[model samples]
Target: MWKHFKFDPNSVNFSCFTDEKFNKFDNLLRFEWEHAVSQDLFMFTIDYNAKQRILDDGDLNYIIGLNRDRQEKRRVPYLFEHVNIPFDNKKFHFNKIKDAEVLFSLDNEQQTDKHLIIINAAPIRPYHVLLVPYRELEQPQVIERNNLISIIFPDVANPMCLDSLCDLLLGQIIETKYVVTADCIVFGCEFVAASAHPYIVAGLNSLCAYASVNHLHLHGMYCPGRMFIQTLKCSVFHTKSNCYLLDSFQPQAFAFEVKHIDEFNKISQDVYKITNYLMLNNIAHNVAIVKGDSFSSADNVLRIFIWFRQSITNGEKFERCNFAFLELSGFMTMPDEKVYNTLTESEMCQHMNRLGLSVEEQERIKDDVKNLLDN
Candidate 1:
């Protein structure tokens, strides 16, 4: 018989419940813990008010949350607010490192076998587990020979880094299965709240498999986590086939291409022009142009990816004053298409010029966008 680990939510100290168990939710074996028990161990909860206090320099040694019924409504437990005791710091070591090797390892076999590693960092999600790569690569943009091997070590460091790591990993995983196919990569980003480390937060971005960069190492998907979530408000429709745009009021979107060294020579100018255009327009975004020669294998097509906010809301205030829940998750507000269409050819050209793109290269991108839209 397989042993199942269980935890009691009401317990004051639930450190003993970190074992693996059969989970009914994912239909696969996973580590399970009681919400109350985890609260006791981590010395915090996903409560926005609590996070705000911490961010304002309040003591973070303890926190409280509403019962399930009051969670969404943000109702206070008038009777139980003072009745339920907060977690005690004496029972746990907040600063101590759990097994560092397990938390940060390059070997896939070693990482897959170990139970999740809980770090001293603030928990972004309930039971947030961070896995760090054993070996640290120099410079975030450099591609390693073994793309898969590279991600294994770094995915755990933090969310900001995880976004790029995810892009690379996704591409490699897809290429290993389908050698030749034109796949589209889609990416998105949102924020996560942190109470313990109030100043720090998290974001997530992901892409589909067909996207590729020419370099053997560049063929994988790449994504990174950010500290904030920016969105635009417009009626944006969703489809699995063509790419969709989320219209926003803020200039928070950005996109870039990834190409193999050989393919880079073919589309480098186009990629440069696009990046220059976005940056010169004062768009708050990131563009990663990965080289194929940096790795053993490379994908042919250059991956053009972009992200911008469609809207921005007072998530922090709502979570704290109203919901008491963490403002980690964001809602997508689509923007007006007419606003995006207002950009004139000359206006775009001027933006490109700011990025130092020559007139000839700007014309090429303009021709390319026009052709893309015409088709």
Candidate 2:
């Protein structure tokens, strides 16, 4: 599936510090980083000092620690791992099935509101729930304005809504006495499955997870996927022995495994940052950040997946067609690479500008995103 879309690994400039015949893990990471750099999809200046430290330690603990220090002092955005257990006997209580139905009914009723329904998802992860306006929105528009604002200006209203949803979901879980452990809040404009208004999940939280439902929503728990689980079982790195795992079966269709919960948290933070950057730069419509695994097993042949949204084509009766692809891995294929590569950044910018995102709008979105994460 990916063979048709495979890109030349040599397209990017990357230098690894090992002569010891590239191993499977090394190859996968190198391929991903190189591909990203080549396409100018992401850029970063690595600290030589930190690089030396990591090489000397030959482990992730010291490296991640150094990275954390850099983030605090230099404000460099990077991805890391995080893990959380959703069950708490004292903080949560089970309800009756009738209560669950009632809670669902209430959510259904709330769907009439604009802001509340836009989020389409609820958070069952304690105090967090996803919220959005009820109107149908484009992905870029949501990120540019709605998501950006929610993240940047996480004021009373945002948190209050999240709390309200959480309270409601908990009520439902209790009603069924379903031994619910955790929940996740997924907020999006169109759910792949629901393909309607945004929605939310109230069950188990899995990291690196993907859902077929398209309604805007959010997940409230941190659950790792099969790939992440496999990676952790073989990893030796530890920091406070806390691990954060994410598993995604879409895009590059892979999973992520990291040693610390903080790292995973960092990834979420980075996602916000990336979204903010796009909106601020007047480049929202044609942008995507997808992560997953490309390998069928954990045998050192994995692929680090990343996808960037390219263009929208009007096929048949105005049905929206989005162009996107996985990097480095030849697993999933697409037919639009040449056209994407031919487009200049300015041309891309113009296209986004046409989508109603202006410079001021971008700034607003950036501010909103910052607020969402800070709070």
Best by TM-score: 1
Residues 310-350 of candidate 1: C-alpha lDDT, one tens digit per residue: 11122211211121101211211112223223423233223
Number of backbone collisions per candidate: 50, 82
Candidate 2 is scored at a TM of 0.23
> Worst ten-residue run, lDDT, model 2?
189-198
Q: How displaced is residue 290 in candidate 2, in Å?
A: 8.5
Task: Give the whole-model CA lDDT for all candidates, comma-separated.
Answer: 0.24, 0.24
Off by over 4 Å in 1: 1-96, 100-120, 131-202, 205-241, 252-375
- Per-residue lDDT of model 2, residues 1-375, tens digit only: 010111122221111111233333224323543443344322233332321111122211111112222223332221111111122233211221111111111121234323331111121111122333332341212232223211121223343577786665555442222221101112221111111101111121111112112233332211111112112222211122221112121111112232222233333333444334543443312211112221233222111121222222221111111122211111111123343224333333343233333446444643554454454
Alpha-carbon deviation at 366 in model 2, angstroms: 19
lDDT of 1: 0.24
**What is residue 207's positional error in candidate 2, in angstroms?**
25
Q: Which segments of model 2 are wrong by more than 4 Å?
A: 1-262, 285-306, 313-375
